[model samples]
Target: MRLVLTGTGASRGMALGRARLEHPSRYLVDERPLEESEVDAEAERLYRAIAIARDELQALREKLHGALAREVAEFIDAHSLMLADRELTSGLFELIRVGRYRASAALKMQRDRLVAVFEAMDDPYLRSRKEDIDHVIGRVQAGLARESSVEERKLAARVGEILVSDTVAPSELVPLAEHGVLGVVLSSGSQVSHSAILARSLHLPMIVAAHQALSHIQDDDLVLIDGERGEIVVHPAAQDLARFRAWQRELAQKGKRLALLRDADTRTLDGTPISLYANAESPADVAQARTLGAAGVGLYRTEFLFLQRKEIPSEDEQFLAYRDLVLGMGGLPVTIRTLDLGADKADASGLVMDDEENPALGVRGVRLTLRHPQILAVQLRAILRASGYGPVRILVPMVSTVEEMTSVRRLLKECARDLRSAGHEIAEHIELGAMIEVPAAAIALGGMIKSLDFVAIGTNDLIQYTLAVDRNNDHLANLYDPLHPAVLKLLAQTIATAQRAKRRVTLCGEMAGDRRYTALLLALGLTDFSMHPGLLLEVRETVNALHREPLRAQATALLRAPTRARIERVVENLKKAVG
Candidate 1:
C-alpha cells in the first residue's frame, strides 16, 4: 500500500511528516477572509453576486426534485422558505447593489455574511454546521466547474487504496469515502476549509499545509502514513510497512465499532444521567445531528451567516438560518452563541489584527465582540427575531466578569426594545448563559452562575489557555493533554462550583464526548455534555449501560489522590467495575 500526503506540493521531491487535523471548523473559517483587492473591484462584485444566486438557484433545483415527490405545496413551501430568507437574499442583493460584486466576489460576500451569523451562535455543534453551508456557498461561488473528468474520478478505482488529486483544490479529498479510497492527503490547502472538515470527519491518515507532496513520489511507490502520529514515510522498508499495516488494522476495528455508539439520553448503573449532545457550527448540521439521534445541539456558531458577503445579514437572513436550525432539531433546543470573532473570523472590513506571536489569545471571540460592540447589536436583533420561531438558548463565550455579562444582557434587552418599537412581538422568553472557559471566569462560576440562567464549560479553550498550550501546534501536541491532572482538577472544580450554586451546567468540549472520562465526569456532577454529533450516541450508550451510583463514589475517592496516574487508575477501575 502507498500514501498521498498533503503538503505544499513543492519541487524538492522529498518532505517530512503529514498534516494532522486541526480544531473543529466551528471555531475557524476554511479560507483566509477575502483579500482586499478581491473585494474592492465593482466588476468582481457583479460577477460574484450573479454566480452565488445562480448557484443557490441550482441547489434549489436539487431540493425541488425531492420536494416534488411530496407535493407541489411542499415544493412551494420550500421555495417560499428560501425566498423569505432575508439574510441570504439580502446578501445576494448587497453583492450586486452595494458591493457590486459578481461570481467569486459575490460568493465571497455571502460567505462573509454567514461568518457574522456564525459569530452570534453559542453552540459548537451549531458552529461546526457552518462547514456544510460553506460547502454549499463555496459550490455556488465556484459555480459548476468539474475539477476532474469522469474518467479522472475513476482513477480512485484503479488504485487498491491510494488517494487522488486534481488541480490545486483538495479535489482528491471528497471521493475517498465513496471511491473505496483508503486515506486522504491533500497536496495544498489553507489551514481552515472544506478540505480540513472532510479530513477530520474521515479521520484520514492525512496532512495539509505542507510542501513537496505531489513531486516527491510516483503513483506506484510504497509509502506509509502514520496519520495518528502525523508522520508520512516514502519508500519505507519492511519494518515501517508492518507497523503501519498493524495500525491500519487496529483503526479499522475502531471504525466498525464507532457506529455502534448511537445518540441517547443514557444513565449509569447507579442511575446518574449523561447529557450527550452534538456540537454543530451551522444550520445544515442540524440534519446530521438528527441522523445521529442527537438529543440537541450544544453549540450553534451563528457567524457563517455573516462572513463572505458584501453586507451584514438582515434579521430575515439571520432568522432563516436560526429558524431552520430550531425547526430542524425536531423540538431539540439549539444553543446559539453570539459572534466570538474579531481576528480569525474577519469580515469584508478584514482582520483587525497585525501579525502576532499568538493570534488565538489576541482579538478573538468575546474579546473581538466587546471592541466592536455595534456588531453585537445587529446579531442580537437577528437572534432575537429568530427566537420567536423555536426553542433557542443564547450563550456568550469568554466572559471574564459580571460586567461583560451585564453589558451583553443590556444589549439583548435593547434588541427586544427595537423589535417592540418596530411593532413586532418578541419571543416569549429566552435562556441566557455564559461559557466557563477562562480560569478567572471558572473561579467566578458561583457568582456568574447565580447571575446567569446557566453555565456551559468550554473545555477546549479552558484547558488550552489555562495550560498555555496551543492545541493547534504540532510541536506542542504532546503537552496539550486534557487528561493532565491539573486540567482535570480545574474541570472538576468548575462543575462543582456550578452545581453548588444550584445552576444548570453543561460541558461542550472535546472532553465531554470522551468514553474514558464518562465515569469520571458523571461522578464529578456533570450531567450535561455537548460534543460532535458523531460521538453523541457512543457516549450515550456508555452512560446508559454503566452504573452511576457506584461510579460517583469511586470518582469522589479518586479525586483525593495526589498523582495523575493514580486518578486515572481509579477512573479505569470505575468503568471496569460498572461493567
Candidate 2:
C-alpha cells in the first residue's frame, strides 16, 4: 500500500520516481467534433466528456468504501458543470471563426486570450479567475495533442488523476460544474475564474498552486485535499486517514446543524428581529437567496452580465436580466449594484479601458459609467423599464467623490423622462445608492451619506485599500484582517451617519458573513446585512439567539479596545456568553 501525504486539492497525486519529485507526467485531454456531426453534437460532446470524467471519479469513490462524505460528492459534481457552460462551448465556435482553426489551434488561441483577459485585470479576485482559465486550457490542449481523432474515448486505464494543465475556458467548465467531477488540477487560477468560483458555489475542494503538483503526483494515486487549508495529502497514513475521516464526519454534522437552523426565524428569545439577506452577483442566484430564508436580496451585483460580452449588453439584454431578478424577488427588495467592475474585471465590450499598471485606481464602477454617458444611458433605460416588473433599486459602486454620484443621477433623470415619454407607467420604484469602498468615501460619509438614498459598505475593498495590502499574496494575507479596529471604526462611522440622516445603510461585503460580528454589528445599531446566500441562515440564527441589550452593551465596550488582539479577545468572550 502506498503511504499518502496530504496537502491540498488538485495537488493530490502520488509522488513519482525519487529523482523528480517536482514534476510528473501530465495527461492531455482535448476534444474535437467531426464535421459530419449534427447541430446537437456540441451538447452531446459536452455530456460525453462529463460522463468520462465522472466515471473516473466514481472509481475513486468506490475504493473509499463510503468513507468519503457528501461534501466530496459536491466536489465531484462541480467539475461536471464546467464541461457544460455555454460560454466555454461558444469559444469552440469562436475558435473556429478565426480562419476555421481546428481543435488544437482553437484551444491554443483561446488559451492565450484567457490569460490576456486576466492579465488586464487589477482586482485580485478577478485576476485569480485567470488562473482557472489557464487550467482549462491545459486540459483542452492535452486532449488535442494526445488524441488526434474526433471520436470519443474513455479515460485511459493508465490515467490516474494526472495533473491537467492549461487555460480552462469558462464555457468548458460549465458541464463539469453540473456533473461535479473535479479530478482535473489547475496550475494557475484566479479569484474571478469561473471554475474557482464554482468550487465555492458547490462546496468543492481545489488547490491553486502547490509548486507544480502535477510533477509530484502519479497518475491515479490516492490523495486527500484540504481545500480550506490549501493542502493536498497524498497516500496518507492509516491513523491520519482515520482522523480525516472523522473530521469529514464532524464538518458534515456541523453543516446539517446549520441546515436545521435555516428555517428558524432570526428572532431572539426576547423578540428582536434581524434582517438577513444574501449577497449575490446574478439574477439566477435569487432563488438560492430565498431558499436561505433571507429577508431580501441585499447586494445584487450586476457586473457579470456586461463583463464578458463583446457588445454593450443591449438595453433588451439588460432589461431581461433585470426583469428576471426583480420578478424573482417576489416583492423582496433587490438592491442592484450597477457595473462595479474595475480593472479587476476586464471587459472587451469596447466600453472599458484596459489600464494594466494601476487598475484599482483606474476608471471603473460609477467612474466608468459617468465617463461613458452612452453606457450609463443604456443600463439606466433597462433599470427603469424593468422597475415596472418588481422591487428594484440602483446601487452605484466605487464612489470616491460626490461629483461621480451627481453625474449618474443627471443621466438617470433623463432615462426616466424617456421611459415616461414612451408611455411606460412608472412609479417611484428606483432608489439611488452608492457603495462606500474607498477610505476617502468612508471619511466623507457625514456629507456624502446625507446626499445619497442609501449607502452600502464594501468591506473587501475597503480593508484591502485601507491596509495597502494585495490580498492575493500569501505573505500579505495576514494583513487583510476583518477585525482591524480601523475598518470597524470606518464601518461604524458610515452606518451612524446614514442612520442620522435617515438613509438606509447595509453591509454587503464578506464581513456580514462573519457570524462572530453579529452582536457587535447589532450593538452598533445597524439592521441590514448582505452576505453569501449559504451563510445567511447561520448568521441569522446567531443574531436571533442574542439578548440584544447585553450584546449591544458588550459590543460597545469591545469596539473601544485598543488593539486587534484585545478586540478578538472580547469577541471570543461575547461568543462564549451567547453560546
Candidate 3:
C-alpha cells in the first residue's frame, strides 16, 4: 500500500529521491561499578574522548571556513565552548571519582541532569539549548565507542539523496547542501528552527515534525517530499508517481518561463514601471540579488551579525561587513535594518533579555534596540560609516509609534555628527525608513509617515499581529491567512495612506514574494517589492503579464469583497485573466 506521511512544511520546494534513513549508532556502555583503581583509567578514557570530539569539531570548523555563512561557523564555535565546559568534563570526572561510576555512566548521568534543567526552562529559546548539549555529548560518546558521528556519515551521503533524520542542526545544513542533498525530512522541528532558516536561504526543500517518518520509512524506499504541502509519499503507487513527475515537469517549465523574464524590466503590460528589490540576510546573498536583477536591497537583516555569538560585535566589525555589502551591490541602495533582534531571533550575545513569557509582544526589534541605546549607537555609527561607500538607507523595524521612528532618526543624526567630529567622511544624506509591521503602526500610518522618508510593510508579522495568530504555532497555522478580510483592509489602508502622502512604500514580506498575491498588491498601488532572490524572476514575470488599470479594478473589487472566499475567488479570476 502507498503510504503518505504528513508534516509541517518548514521550507518551500519539492524533491523526489530514494530514502536514506540516518540512524546514529547507540553504544551500550558497561555500567558495572568501577573499583577505585579502575576509576583513574576510566577518567583518562573519558578525557581522551572529549579531546577527540573537540579536535573533530575544530577540524569541521576549519573545513567550513569561507564555505558557509559566518553565523554557521560561530554556531560550531559555540559547540566547541560546550565541549570545553567544566560542567561536562570536570563534573563528569568528579562523578567517576566520588561515585565510583564507570566513565560512560558518569557522562550519561551528567548529560541527563543538564538536559533536565534545560527542559524545565519556561522559554522555548532557552529550552532549545538542550539540543546543543546533546549534539556535543553525542560526539564524545561516538568518540568513546571509536565510531564516526552520524553527521560525518551524513556528510558522506551521495548527491541528490534524501536524508531522513530525527532532527537536523543548523550547522549541518551547509554541509548537506554542499553534498547536494535533494530534500530533508525531520521528525522534529518548527519554522523558527535554524534548520528551516538555512534550508530556505539555500533554497532546499525541507519537511519537519513528521511524526511517523522514521518508524514507517524504510531504507531505499522511493520518497516524494512536497515542501509546499508538507506531505511525504513513501513508496508511492505508479499512478501517484506519474502525477508527481508531471507536477515536477510543470514546475521546471515554470522556472524556464521565469528565467526568460530575467532581463525584462519590472513593468506592467501597460508600461508602468515598478521597483523590485531582494531581501538579503548576508553579503553572500548580495550576489544572488544582483543576479536576479534587483534594483537594490530592500531589506538587509543586520541582526544576523549579532546572533549565535558570545558578545556584541564591535563597531569596526559591523562597519566592515556593512561596507562590504554596500560596495558589493555596486552602488545599489542597501537598506540596513538595525538589530531587529528579539523574539524568535534571540541572540546569546547577552544583549537580548529572554525573560518575557510572550516575546512577540515584549521588547523586540526597535523596542529592544532603544532599551540598549549604546548598542544602537554603535550600529548607527557603523551604518553611517558604510553609507560613505555607497547609497545606504537605515530602516527601523517594529515601530508602533511615530516617537520610536523619530528617536531613531535623531540617533542617526547624532551618530553622523560623532563620526564627522572624529574626522570620518560620512554621507551628507542617508535615507531613513520605518518598517510597518505592527497593527498599531498600520492604523497610525498617517501620523508615522510624515516623520519617515519611506516605509516597508512587513506583512508576515503584520498579518500575524493583526489576526492575533502566532504564525509558528502549528495549531494556529490554519488561521494565519494573508488574504483574510481584516489583513486586506489593513494593507489597503497602509498603501492608501502612503500614496496619499506621496511617500515611497514597499512590501518587503512573504506576501511580496508569493506570485499569487503579486497582482493583488500591484492593484493596491504597491509599486515596490522586496523578496527572497529565488522569487525575484517569478514575481517580475507576474508583473510583466499584468496591466495596471485592470489590476487596479480587480484590486478594488477584492477590497470590497466581504468574505475570504470571495476575495480568494477574485484573486484566482485575476490570475486566470492575466495568464
Q: Which candidate tops TM-score?
A: 3
Count of residue pairs whose backbone atoms collide, per candidate:
100, 84, 0
Residue-level lDDT of model 2, residues 1-579, one tens digit each, is: 544233234222222111112122243323354353432444344334434544544453343212112223333333333344556657866555433455555556666776787667655544544544544444444444444211122122122232333233333333333343443445554332344444554444455545456555665556655555555556666765776678768767878878887677787656777788887655446787877788888887676666444787889888888888888878888887887656545454667675445667778888888888898898888888888887777899999888888888888998999889999865475789999999999999887765588888888789888887655533355576777888878878888889889998899876687676787787776788888787787787688677776666676667798889998887776664464
- Taking the tens digit of each residue's C-alpha lDDT, what string does model 1 give over 167-207? 22233343443444455444444323434433544444455
* Residue range 242-355, candidate 3, lDDT tens digits: 877898899899888878877779988888899999988776678888887999999998866786678899999999999999998998898999888774453677777755
Best by lDDT: 3
Model 3: colliding residue pairs: none
TM-score quality measure for candidate 2: 0.71
Local accuracy by lDDT, each model: 0.60, 0.63, 0.82
